[model samples]
Target: MKRNIVIASVAAAALLTGGTAVAVAGTQSSSTGAPTTHAADAAGTTAGESFSDAAHASGTTARASFSDAAHAALKAVPGTLDSLDLDHGARTTWDAEILGKDGKWHEVTLDASNAKVLNQHIDRDTDAEDAAEAKALRNADVSATEAARKAASSGTVTSVEFDGDRTPVWEVETVKNHKERDLNVNAQSGKVTQAPSDDDGDDD
Candidate 1:
């Protein structure tokens, strides 16, 4: 009878030990899986933050638009805009020429990124041709802005300059589908025409 009891006790202890081992193994697996899930979530969050930071940097480095630079030039000069050009060299800049009410031409330079005026000067070396061009411009019915809007029907206008060659016109340069186009808009009748190409086969 004693031997039977001993054998039964030994069997119960073995069963209990096996059950404890299984419970311990289950706890270890659950703990390990939890850390892996947390690591994956953290990695995802870091990647999202990196993308957002890159986007912000790109936005900060982009140049200002054409309209913004024109507005800034007008605000600084407070005159009739004659020509505006985007110049790229060591630094990108917007060069603006304005005819003031005092019959003098003002040249203004602005930073392309923030539209801040960098330099300005009055042109005192005016001649008969300058006076004639200014007079024709003032007498014209259409303005530079109107000419640009009319030219924009063809493509995106990049620059506008007063061309006083045979007839008073606003020369507008545009780009569309990666092709550059030069258009001349009449300052009086608001007529648009193709500009003559400057390349006279000098390379040939």
Candidate 2:
């Protein structure tokens, strides 16, 4: 198990180095552990706005856009932003994080086009999941946001992940005109170069 940095106060919460949520603030508020929340897209927004600004706009989409979205999703979270990543996966989304909301950290993904939330997950710094995720983050040549933008040439990116085989690679999956394809991007080189995923779906 990977150890988290020592957390003494909320002020020190947002200093995540590797997906660590050193502290979460509330004892009374209950959160749905890793919930998949889907709501209608925010209406009447022009394109090319910064994700942080768009999330501050309004409604359900407001519940899941950028920093404010992460803020409202939970009762008490960190004040500082750890990492903000943008991607075209699942409709041009922003995957961002804030640290030490009590003993857990928050990650909220939002659609850039309409400012819709795709998913949200909270993790304690001590969770085993954080270890793997942190490793994946280390292996990436580009953010999921960039991979998704590149993926558009293939099709609409449905999802992305850092695949750890002998090396780190971004597994970008896409669907275009009702067809799907999986691509492997070199984490170090940021190239869309790798053989297709094996039949068993393993990178080996």
Candidate 3:
């Protein structure tokens, strides 16, 4: 009977040791799985943040095209379009100058996003230069839109400004391959030509 008791005690101890080993293995597996889960979650969060940043950047860069802004300006003040410039301020805006039918120059500000008219006012400050520009615009058979189209072959037209020098022309700025190019479109003949560079050392 004593020998039988000893054998039973040995069997119980072995069972206990096996159970302890299984418990330790289970604890180790749980610990390993927890770190992997946390790592996966962290990776997902980082990817989400990166995607959000890219989306925000795209939203901020979105803007109304120059053509749309011009149309909005002309609608606000009916006249001959003179110049349109993209102005960067607290808000992106388009500063447009138009010669109104009332023989006055009107400055119109438009939102760059939706081409909404932000402000409009007559520019009372006129000079001989302004008068010359107006006369040139009146005589030009090629409209600003035409000038832009003619210069489109050069690149994307960014702005169009009137140049009332001896040879009246529409000074159009274009961007091609991320490089800025200046082209002169004859206001009367709709001819496109390269504009003189600032460092060309031409007095005229």
Q: lDDT score, residue 201, model 3?
A: 86
- State model 3's lDDT: 0.54
Clash totals, every prediction = 0, 10, 0
In order, candidate lDDTs are: 0.51, 0.39, 0.54
Evaluated against the true structure, the overall lDDT of model 2 is 0.39
Compare candidates 1 and 3 on lDDT and give the better one: 3
Per-prediction TM-score = 0.64, 0.42, 0.67
Best-first order by lDDT: 3, 1, 2
Residue 200, model 1: lDDT of 52
Error of 2 at 5 (Å): 25
Each prediction's RMSD over C-alphas, in Å, is 34.6, 14.8, 34.0
Per residue, candidate 1 scores C-alpha lDDT tens digits across 77-172 of 655667766555466566777666556778888785666899998978777778776666565556555666677555444466776656878777
- In model 2, residue pairs whose N, Cα or C atoms come closer than 3 Å (at least 3 residues apart or on different chains), thus clashing, are 23-102, 23-103, 24-101, 24-102, 24-103, 25-101, 25-102, 86-145, 87-145, 141-187
Better of 1 and 2 by TM-score: 1
lDDT of 3 by residue, 1-204 (tens): 000001111101101000001100000012222100000000001111222232232233325545566667766776677777655557656677777767788888887567789999988878887777777677666666667667756544556777776787878765443356788999778899998888888677
Off by over 4 Å in 1: 1-62, 200-204
